[model samples]
Target: MIATRDAYGEALAKLGEENDNIVVLDADLSGSTKTSLFAKKFPERFFNMGIAEANMIGTAAGLAAAGKIPFASTFAIFAVGRAWEQVRQSVAYPKANVKIVATHSGITVGEDGGSHQSVEDIAIMRAVPNMTVIVPADGIETALAVKAAADFKGPVYVRLGRNKVPTIFDDTYKFEIGKGVMLRPGTDITFIGTGLMTAQALVAADLLQAEGISARVIHIATIKPLDEEIILAAARETGAIVTAEEHSIIGGLGGAVSELLSEKCPTKLKRVGIKDRFGLSGKGDELLKYFGLLPENLVEAAKEILAEK
Candidate 1:
């Protein structure tokens, strides 16, 4: 198992070798955010902006204006919450080629409590006009996402977690900005998931298979600019939908899928995520299970949705 933030740091370091225009910026959490690895590799190109997230974001914007591909790293709460106005006014407004890779997002930043955790980051980022929002499933997907974000020209927000997670993708996996990948094929019901919840969805599929139920599993890596075509196809085929994410159901992955289906397909759907509540401090796995984001919870949701169908 590997943490996505670990893959992010390694990917940024490798990208530095390939592109000379690439630079890294961090607020005070380089060690936790793992951007310190890049700083070690390229001291000249790394900028430690201290504990000032707003300043760090503005500095990244300036670097983008100077034709540098700046990657800003920090905790999700500070990156989005503390410096939201700066990010909105500076980088995203200009459509800068700045990558904001935030680690320890959602309820997985265990033991940090609700104040440090960020459940609204994805929602706010998706609301921005020119920003691209992505939440990779695992370390392998995180590497691919970092590389893809670098090549794409725009403001990108990549959300990663702190704990090590099961690898869902291999070396052959290809990640597109606004495309969903189907991991398993089924006709009874469809499970659309993002982040670590995608792994749980796969597990739920296995459990359902034992009960003679065919469940289709689709991983949505890109939250904003969602793959509506793929989702609509799934709704047309499966007839029922269940969305899982390591975020609140209000305005995250669940909300995005709900909006899409309501406008286009209008199918029976169930969302598996935090029920618009704040996360408490605990172990990552425990918090996930407590919030009903486990495979068993997904199985129950699928069965309930299937019964309605």
Candidate 2:
């Protein structure tokens, strides 16, 4: 098991070796965001942007305009909430080659309370034009995503969490931007999950299998420009859908899937995430359970959708 941010830091350092134009900027949270690994390897290319999140974003945009791939790192809340105007006006609007890889996202931020936790970052970033949003499932996926973000042009936002999670994908796993991977096949219901919840979806699939539920698990690593083809296929095949994420049920993965299915298929759907409420200080695992984001909750949601079907 490994934290996705750890993989991201390692991947950024490795990418720096191959691409000299790759630079890193952090708003005084390199250690928390794990960008310190990259700073250690490429100190000259790393810029400590102090506590000014907006300034860090503007500097990254300037670096991008000068032909550098600037990776801006900070807490998710600060990156999206504090520096949103700069991100929208400087980086995203100009389609700059900037990667905003924010860590410590969601209720899993743990003990930091609602102010530190970022439940709406995904929604707001996805709303920006020319901005690609990604939520990798595991360390392997995170590494691939970092590489993908470096290679892809324009603005990108990659959301990562603080807690260590189960390694769901192997080295053989290939990640494609805006594509969803079907981890398990089923005919009864589809469990569409993103970020760490994708790992939970796999576990929930096992629990359902024992009960002959036949749940299909689809991991959505890319939230923006969603894999509509794959999602529609799952909805058509399974007839019922359950979307899970570590963020809010409003405009994260659940909202994206709900929008797609409503327009394309209109399948029975349930969302597993923090309802319209703020996160509180607690242990990471405890927070997940408190918000009903565990495998048992997913299994129950699947059963409910099945019952309705």
Q: How well does candidate 1 score on lDDT at residue 244?
A: 95
Model 2 regions more than 4 Å off: none
lDDT of each: 0.94, 0.94
Every model's TM-score: 0.99, 0.99
Question: Candidate 1's residue-wise lDDT over 113-208, tens digit each?
Answer: 999888888888888889899999999999999999999999999999999999989999989999999999999999999999999999999999
Question: Relative to the unseen true structure, what is the Cα RMSD of model 1?
Answer: 0.7
Task: Return the TM-score for candidate 2, rounded to 2 decimals.
Answer: 0.99
Model 2 residue 157 lDDT score = 97
Candidate RMSDs in order: 0.7, 0.6
Off by over 4 Å in 1: none
